[model samples]
Target: MEFPDGLVADTFARTWEMLLPSGTPGTAGLPARKLALAGPGLPDPGPAADIVLVPTHPQTGKAWQPPSGTAAVVPLSAEVWLHLAFPRDRLLVPATGGLPDGVLRDDPPPLHPAAPFRPDARIFFGTLARLPAVREPWLRTLHDHARHRFPHSFR
Candidate 1:
């Protein structure tokens, strides 16, 4: 799928942050660590990214598996994409101000390894639009981004 330029621009404009689960070196337990997305000359005045995540390993307390001369791209599934996209601290409340019927309030789901992570603007906003809880400014933002980034894809 192709993304519109606007969406790509917005995505590149802001630094995306995610806390991901990692296997601790000595223990079986999984711990969360802060990961910052980076790429050379990213967040360009225009839209685009060659994204790579810089993660701090909890066990080593250091940068985990730094990318070589060129950053590695990882492919992720829609479910795993959603998990990383939304903010971890807040519950996703619809504009209606209540949980949609039948939607349950429970612990946030875990991220399954679908594939390696990659920064593709098209996939990112496409997945964002697919999320059920999205609304308002966010929805508009996604649409605008998609429209601007990949005009033909929508038509």
Candidate 2:
């Protein structure tokens, strides 16, 4: 099944909207880039790397099939890792209290196996692994802390 770039963007935007808080007060737009239309893929240097969007089923572990015709694989400055186990709700920022920035360095938060994770956490990262991007090491550190030390919640 082939979906247009706009359709994919709409789907992605809708999912994010449901996950984000209502009345959060932010202008909305979907960031979908055309892969072929975009320039050639270059080696990512530091912060200029592109992120991967791994599509998978939560229970079946089946990777999602991208819609046909002009699949827009937008290259991101930051990494975006997707897993069914990841919490898509509110994220915990550094100001959430109870955790220092260093706490995220050495271990996984503990509830990584669960869903609807920490309130201040912005994204889901795996304890032992992370998408290979420019910030790969840092993101892996954060994921380690999440899977080992923090709590997990569900909606």
Which consecutive 10 residues in model 1 have the weakest lDDT in total? 17-26
Task: Give per-residue CA lDDT, model 1, range 25-91, as digits (tens).
Answer: 1122222222233323233212232334433434554443323424333333333333344335335
**Tens digits of per-residue lDDT for model 2, 1-155:** 11224423333444333433331213222232222112213122222223224344455655443333233244322212222213343355445566765666355443442533223433443313345652454434444444444445212
Instruction: Kindly provide the TM-score of model 1 when superposed on the true structure, using C-alpha atoms.
Output: 0.24
Candidate 2 lDDT score at position 19: 36
Given candidate 2, what's the lDDT at residue 72? 27
Each prediction's TM-score versus the true structure: 0.24, 0.21
Per-prediction backbone clash count: 14, 22
Q: What ranges in model 1 sit over 4 Å off? A: 1-121
**Model number with the top lDDT:** 1
